[model samples]
Structure formats: structure tokens, C-alpha cells
Target: MTEFNDKQIDILQAAEKLFAEDGYDGTSIRTIAKEASVNIAMISYYFGSKEKLLEALIIHRTSGMKIQLENIFKEDLLPIEKVERLIDLYISRINKNKCMYQILHFELSTKKRIMDMNAFKDVKYENLQAFTKIIKEGQELGHFRKDVNITLIPPTIMGTLVHFQMNKPFFEPVLGIKTEEEYENYIKNELTAHIKQTIKALLVHEN
Candidate 1:
């Protein structure tokens, strides 16, 4: 069995949990080391610094998700099926990295502190190209309406799926829902239905 030293595993797990709860500026290397039960200096020895560790965590999570999406969209599927699969992938990835997603999203929504170029230094081009390819295929196959702008669709679709995670607590207060499981079911039904109908309105033709 592949084994990680307790200190190493502890650092990673501690960083992930802390970063999830407290965003980049709010989390500290000392706090992480303390949480991990390791020397504060050991964080630098292991990961160089707080920022590098955060960067590595993002890269690790995104790369795994990128590979999965690339494989999922490889086959030329039907229009509705493709939409369903895309939402399914987003929902699945969000569930897998709920904490990391929260941290990354905080950075995204903030007006003043979005990620700088250095933050995404190791990002894969294939991740972006895959989404572009999917849209291009839909256009080529005449599944997506010719009038609909391909460039605009993907980002809108991403925003729609992200809404569940981004505005979660607000949803409970506004809609009077309880429990994460109930909230997830609400998102599944609501977002899937919204995506299906919105895509139909945008791209599908029915007489």
C-alpha cells in the first residue's frame, strides 16, 4: 500500500479543511501547522508556503475533474443527453470537492481579489478546449440552434450550475428548506429542469 507519513497527510487534510472554512487571506500557515499537529516550519519544508499549498490544492482538484469531463464528452451524444451529462458532471464534481469549490468560488465572486495569472500558472488548456469542442460539435451537428451564440452558452451554463453552491444558505432562508440532502434534491430537480428548458428555449426547435 502506498503510505504517506502522518505529518504529510495531516498537513494536506488540515489545509483543505481550513481553507474550505476560511478563504486564502483568512487562513494562515501557522494555523494549518497547528491543526495538523506539525511544526509551523514544516509547512514551508513540505509545500514552500501558504500560497503554494493553495495553488497545489486547486491544481490537483481541477486536473482530476478536467480528465473526467474530457472522457465524458468524447462520444457524440444527442443534444438533450449532452446537456444532461454536462450538468451531471458539474454536480458530481461539486459534490466531490465541496470544500475546495467553496474556496475557489469565494475568490471568483469577490470584486477586488480574483485569481491572478500566477494562481492558474499550471492550468491545463485541454480543460477549456474540451468545453469549446462540445459547443462546436453541437453547432456542427445542428443540434444547437444556429441563432444561439456558442461563445455565450458555456459560461451561462456554468453560472447556472454554480448558483446552487454559491447561494446555498440564501436558498434555505428564502425557500425554507432544511438539510443538505433536501437542498441537493431541490438543486437537482430545479437546475436540471431549468437547464433542460432553458436550452430548449435557446437551442431546440419544436413546433
Candidate 2:
């Protein structure tokens, strides 16, 4: 992972917020500069161009998760335990970086391409590779089903979280979630448990 100075971190955060609010095409380098309280030249100096800035921001936000996923395999735990830890790690990261995740979701859902898709997909693939390693370990241990479709695991986890995020307003009212804190707690606890349980069922061998 790349180590960013305070200025670079500020600029990336500013870009993240702007991208989430205004969409990538609607935001400009000048807007990010103002948001970060830095000159336009600073962004150019650090990231070169808008496309590179977006790529850097995506990498900055996601690289930690990928690293953590890789580190999970080194921990002293059963394969199933490692998988559950991955579920928790993902939920916590997504919850903390809501703006960045929202930016990614918006870019993916829209027809107009604003950011570099390949960069985004590359980060995702790295994370998936780490995740697949755990699943394969479990399969080798006779803990997970051999026939499980490993490719679908990421989507199963990400798609459910995306659906919950997109439909929060509907879900909040239906679930009687009356406050922001309540909704966040529900996501971190209830939603995380649900996803862990779902994945466990999908991956675990039948009794």
C-alpha cells in the first residue's frame, strides 16, 4: 500500500466526497482543490490528472481491505473462522467508507463512464483472489463444499450490502429504524450477521 502525506490524504478525501455528491463528471479539480483547501497545482503534482487522481483515491481507499484480506490467511484460525473474519472486515470497512463506496456504486450503476474502470476492477480482483484462497483452504479441509461457485461469493456479499445501502430509506422505515445511528448499528450488527450466515450456508459442507 502507498503511504500518503496529509495533503494527499486531504485531497483524496475531498475528491471522494465530491464524487459521491456530484458524481465524477460533475466534479472538477478546482472543486476538489477548494474542498481540500489546497491549490490546484498540488493535486496535479501528486496525482497528475483527474483520471489518475480518481485511480489513486480508489486505490488509497481499497488497498487496506485487500491487504487485510491477505493478512487473514496468516492468522491462527480455522478456515471457516477466517471466512467469518473476512465478512466482518468487509462490513466494517464499507460502513466506515460510505462515501467512497457510494462513489463506486454510482460509477458502476450509471451508463456514463467517468472513472477508470480497469483500475477499480483490478482492486476488486485482488481482494477476490485473497478471498478465494480462504475458500479453497476450507474446501481442502473438508469444511466448505467443493462444488461451490467461488466466483459468485464476492457478488453475494457485495450485492447484498449494495442493495441494503441503496434501499436504506425503504428498509429504515420498514424496520422502524428512526435514526442514523440506529441504521448504522443495524448495518454493522444485524446486516453483518445475516451476510455471514448466508455465506456460511453457501460455503460450508452439508452435515
Candidate 3:
């Protein structure tokens, strides 16, 4: 498990918040230091540089996901059930780690090369490969469509969740959402159900 002192965690949390608000390129070491309530040298000492800090943040956010997915795979359940569990797991994690998810989506959409760098590429590939195995196994078991593109499924799932998350301000009035708790409930329940149904349809829909 990746471990961080309380101060390191504070710095990371501050960075995540700043990255969400300011964009990665716009946020600087000085800003992070101030937000984190640490001196500039402390960040440099703990994380080396801004790039390495970003990498550490990614690692911290994603380190648990692969293991969780692997354990879900080991469960004695049907392929569709496993897929449903995976969906729930993802939605739960993403909601809890919204900042990390936002940062990840931002980097992927605008700074593709950053995701491919040595820092994040392995974890990304490992996650993709793990999900690929799940889908392939489902196909082999005659549970999922053989023609489904496993490569696209992860992005599709993530994009759907991120869209709903990032558009809450625009959607709230339109969708009749009134309060933060209600909006969170909508995501935790209704939106999650929507994603589950959507994924199920995609996996089983006739081509």
C-alpha cells in the first residue's frame, strides 16, 4: 500500500483541489505550498517536482482500484454479476475520489502524453488489461457480445460518470435537483442505475 504522512496527504489533497479549480498547468508550486500550508521546500523535499507530485497523486488515488477489481473477478458469480459489481465499484470510487477522477479526465482529454508517461502508463495499462480479461472471459463464457470493444468500454464508463459529475451545475436546475444531498443521492442511486443499465445494454445489445 502507498503510505503518506499526514502532511504529505494534506499536500496531495490541496493539490487535487487546486488542480480541479485551476487546471494542472495553471496551478504552481507556490500555490500548492500556500494551499497546503507548507513551505515550498517541503513540497520539493517530499515530491521532488510538480510532475512527480502529480504522479504520486495518481498512484495514491489508483493504487486500490486494481486490487479491488481483481478481488471482484475472483468472486463466484456470473459474468454479468461481476460486471454489475464492477460498475458499482467504479461509481463508488469515482464519487469518493472526484478530484482524482477529474484530474485524470482532464489529463486524458487535453494532455494525452502525460497519461502515457512513465508515471501513469503502467497503472493505466494494468487496469485496462484487467478489465479486458473480464470482458474476454465473459465473451468466452457466452455471456457478453463477442464484438464488443473492450478497449472502449472503460473510457465509455468513465466518460458517462464524469459527464454527469461535471455537469451538475447545469443539470441541477434542468433536472430539478435542489440540494447537495439530493444531487448526491441522484448520483449514488439514479445515475448509478442508469450506468448499470446502459452497460448491460451495451454488453448484451444485438449488433
Best by TM-score: 2
Go through the candidates in order and give each one's C-alpha lDDT: 0.69, 0.87, 0.84
Each prediction's TM-score against the native? 0.77, 0.91, 0.87
Over the full model, what C-alpha lDDT does candidate 3 score relative to the true structure?
Answer: 0.84
Please, what are the lDDT tens digits per residue for candidate 3 over residues 1-207?
267899999999999999989988899999999999999999999999887788889888876678888988889988888888988888888889899888877787776454425546677688787777788788898889988978887777788888998998898999899999999999888888888888888887476
Q: Which one wins on lDDT?
A: 2
Better of 1 and 3 by TM-score: 3
Give the better candidate number (1 or 3) by lDDT.
3
Q: Give the root-mean-square deviation of each candidate in angstroms.
A: 3.9, 1.8, 2.6
Cα lDDT over the full model 2: 0.87
* Residue 37 of model 1, lDDT score: 88
Q: Which parts of model 1 have CA positions greater than 4 angstroms off?
A: 1-10, 108-125, 205-207
Error of 2 at 185 (Å): 1.3
Model 2 is weakest, by summed lDDT over 10 consecutive residues, at: 111-120
In candidate 1, what are the lDDT values of residues 1-207, reduced to their tens digit?
123466766787788898877767888998998888889888898778776677666665666555666776776677557666766776667667778767776766674453443535434455556655666667788776667665565556667767767787787878878888888887778766786677667776555
Candidate 3 segments whose C-alpha is farther than 4 A from its true place: 1-3, 112-116, 205-207
Q: What lDDT score is found at residue 160 in candidate 2?
A: 90
Rank order (by TM-score, best first): 2, 3, 1
